[model samples]
Target: MDQWIKTILEEFGAIGVGALMLLENVFPPIPSELVMPWAGYSVSQGKSSFLAIVSAGSAGSFAGAWAWFWFARRIGKERLANWVDAHGAWLTITRDDIERVDHWFNDWGAAAVLLCRMIPGLRTLISVPAGFANMPPEKFSVYTGIGTVAWTALLAAVGLWLGKNYGDLARPLSWVSTAVIACLFSIWVYRLVQQRRTGSPHKVR
Candidate 1:
């Protein structure tokens, strides 16, 4: 993974950042933690502009979000739920989180879509619930666009600052990002385990 990221940084640079962000949103396994920082470092190296990199990343994120939203809208809740139950591993969604998201979507309406994008793991997954709830297309796009751009810009800034200390920062930044990803995955796994053991649902909101 490290070698792959380094290669992308060396070759495509900021464009790689955008592509990876899109993939990250659509696929979840592609870590934006690594991509954003690399883009930041590239900016520091004068390889790319920070604003441009953020824009590309945000665009990719929006595309991914839209894809999920459309899927939800088309499939409807019962069908999507059955499909998720059959192929749960690939989806990475929990019944509890789904229930909670549904409740929030019902209570908050279109506003929940914007708020959900601000949360870490919830950002991409929220689109699914929004779609299922039949959120207005224009509203979803507007809120998602605002949130995606803000989040991407924030991460890019962090990357740019780390890039300033390129020699000393690279190793530490790599470790930090790795640790964060590991922790997040661990939490997700732990939640799954707890859900299984206790047969309790996850609550959203």
Candidate 2:
């Protein structure tokens, strides 16, 4: 993963950063943690500009989020549920969870979409629920844009700072990324456990 990131940074620079962010939002496997910091390192190496990197990353995120939004609109809830039931194993979303997501969309509306972007795994899945709930396109776009920009800027800054440290930056950055992901995962797991214990289902409301 590290070598692939370095190669992309060396070869494609800011464009690579943007593309990765887009893929991360759509696919969920691509890690922005690796991409943004590498872009920062590239800037430190005089290979790219910080503004360009951030811009690309943000644009990619917006595009990806928009795609998901439209997808939700097209598929709607019943069809999506059917599709999930058939292929849910691949994505790991359960029937109960899908129903809960639908409930969240109904209760919290677009704000749930925005908050989901800030979360790790929930980010991609929220789009489906947002679609299921039939959230307003304009509101969804606005909130999604805000979340994407904030996330992109935060990651870019971390990358930039680490880039300055050169050889020393990689280890610390890796450790930090691992810790952050672990913490986020733990919190999510805790919430899931709590929800299960309460018999309140997985939906936020």
Candidate 3:
């Protein structure tokens, strides 16, 4: 997968960065951790400019997040809530879990959108809550843009700093990614155990 990502960035330049970011946002399994840094390393190698890679990556992430927000908006809150209530267990997310996010969005508004884009797991899922809350598209764009640019720039910069050493650091970065995934899995397990002990507010159908 790492080699595949590197090849795309090598062959397609900034466009490949944008495309990968879009897919990453829509499908959370695609790691931006890998994409942004690789693109940055490419820039260091003079394959592309810093501004172009960052801009394309940010644009792609924004578009992918918008896609989810738009879809959730079309679904509407009640129907989505009902679906979640029935089947959220498989995803380890309940309607109540969603409602907590909704409340957090209500409390934090645009800040919530901006900050979440930088978070690994929350980056993509945050869009759904925003959609459910019917946050104005323009507002979403402003915050999401700010957040994605900051995030893309940060990761790309890390790669740029690493330069030729980026290859050496790849294994360490993979381990970090693995640790992140493990932590997320642990959180899910904790949630599941808690749910069993206390019972969910809404019974899964």
Best-fitting candidate, scored by TM-score: 1
The Cα local distance difference test for each model comes to 0.77, 0.74, 0.85
Candidate 2 RMSD computed on C-alpha atoms after optimal superposition onto the true structure: 4.8
Instruction: Flag regions of model 3 displaced more than 4 Å.
Output: 164-205
True lDDT of residue 163, candidate 1 = 76
**Model 2 agreement with the true structure over 21-92: per-residue lDDT tens digits:** 899888765667767777776777778998999899888888888888789889787776666566654354
182 Cα displacement, candidate 2 (Å) = 9.9
Ranking by TM-score: 1, 3, 2
Least accurate 10 contiguous residues by lDDT in model 1: 196-205
Lowest summed lDDT across 10 adjacent residues in model 2 is found at 196-205
What lDDT tens digits, residue by residue, belong to model 3 across residues 19-95? 99999998776779889988888877878999999999999999999998998899987787788788777567788
lDDT of 3: 0.85
Q: Which scores higher on TM-score, 1 or 2?
A: 1
CA RMSD of each candidate after superposition = 3.4, 4.8, 2.9
Q: What TM-score, over all chains together, does every model reach?
A: 0.86, 0.79, 0.82
Question: What's the CA error at residue 68 for candidate 3, in Å?
Answer: 1.7
lDDT of 1 by residue, 1-205 (tens): 5457757866886677778888888877666777777777778878888888898888988898999999989988777666556556434565555668788788987777777776777788889889997888998999999988888888889878877865446677778767877887787787678667765333321
